[model samples]
Target: MRSALLHVSVPFVLCVTLANTSLFDEVKVDLAYDHYAERRVDYLPSFLAMPCNCLVNLAYIYMGLYWLLNCRGVKETEQGRYMREVFAFMAVLYAPVQWVRLASLRRAPAVLDQWFTLPIFAWVPVWISSIQRRPARWRAPGAAVVQLLSLLSYGLSLAHERGFEVALGCHVAAAVYKGACVQRDLGDGRTRVYLLLAVLSCAGFVVLKLLDHWLSRYWLFQRLTGHFWSKVCDVLQFHFSFCFLTTLTQRAQGKTASQEE
Candidate 1:
């Protein structure tokens, strides 16, 4: 899995090195230490400049590892397994990309950080598509197409100041809308809980990050900071997404088996 992810990400990372970025105008990227509410420790290395924010990125890896390793609890189709693995791989990959941005505070890593986000969010709908039917051969191609479109949407950042925001908003909206619909149609009480938690986490991930600086005026948000909490929320959302998708996939598989028998 790691090898496959490397094969996919290495070229993408290289491409990001060649890509132009929107540090100031388009996306809200924190370039300097002052951009974050967490105070940088002068004694620490550059990687741990903002200790809380830096250390929090490890949560993504841990969450991804938890999902990636625990594949035994539920049985799923080949396509469903593929979807889960790819999403887990994305979480694992995302950790370092964000860390590198905080460490280097460079253009490429920052750009790569934001660019990678779109496709990750886009996967929600692709996973929903998988739930809508039996596992088919074409699911992979369909997923690839969704991801490709998501990747190309980053081009909007170069074209407009708020383009990335617009793209991200659409992705989030689509994920929420589709998730809500699926939960309404086919979900039980447990899946409903997962979906609600995922949505709340998604909201926290966005709202907290947006309020990073503003929230710092309060005492509670001073140390760990809004950004750090936002990361925590992001990890929670990832975990819940895994929960929701896997549970739904397992149920779908059971229904299929029953019909077959």
Candidate 2:
């Protein structure tokens, strides 16, 4: 299973690496004060000019792909159902976020830039509506955890210029927590292994973030570029792990059913 995961991860890693390179070049251009200043003169172009905006857009694409491939029609147990609900909730929340992006900024904020911070209110009611229909088991602790992290990340972003970092960290942490919750609910060895790998990948990201913070320097762009490459590796690892575990679980289930027959 581990070997299979490594195989699946290769392409994702390559894509992330390429994306990082592109992001670095784009951000470097964005950092040029004169270019940025001139671009801001035209609101539409300036908003579109930010590389962080592009990164966020790309991240959304990845999120959608992950949901379609991993979350849709893949629930094998009640825990799996809960997991799906969580992601569905996320999808709901992200809808307004994307909409606001289009209507308000049309571009992404920098790591240090502040924009509209209260967009959560727009979609909070949607999540609440969904939560009300779900089973009570899926309501309290599970929904609480997800909502707490979501709101906390937004608040952190508002309080600090480096709010993007807080948001990313919260996201990684939520993924790990969700994986663990699913693993506990499923009781499948293969699924548990995949969850562990997901946790590890998120841990790798946390470490990279800490390193970046501790080693701050004026020429931090170089360091950020390096971290971006590392992020690519982690994403690849996550993709491969998920693919292999999913395959293994399906195969094992097939064997069990055949044996019963």
lDDT of each: 0.84, 0.40
Candidate 1 lDDT tens digits, 40-157: 8989999998888999999999998888878956666667777788889889989998999999997677878888899999989988888876764345677778888998888788
Itemize residue pairs with steric clashes in candidate 1.
Answer: none
Tens digit per residue, CA lDDT, model 2, 1-261: 233234223422443354344332322112332322111234455334433322343443475357445565663434333333343333333433433443344234321121122222212222322332333223545444544445445445445556555565545544455445444544477656665665566566456534543343435533343244334444544454444334444444455456669
Q: How close is candidate 2 to the true structure, as a TM-score?
A: 0.40
Clashes of each: 0, 1
Query: Lowest-scoring 10 consecutive residues by lDDT in candidate 2?
Result: 111-120
Model 2 residue pairs with clashes? 53-108
Q: Which stretches of candidate 1 lie over 4 Å from their true place?
A: 1-11, 14-17, 20-29
Predicted model with the maximum lDDT = 1
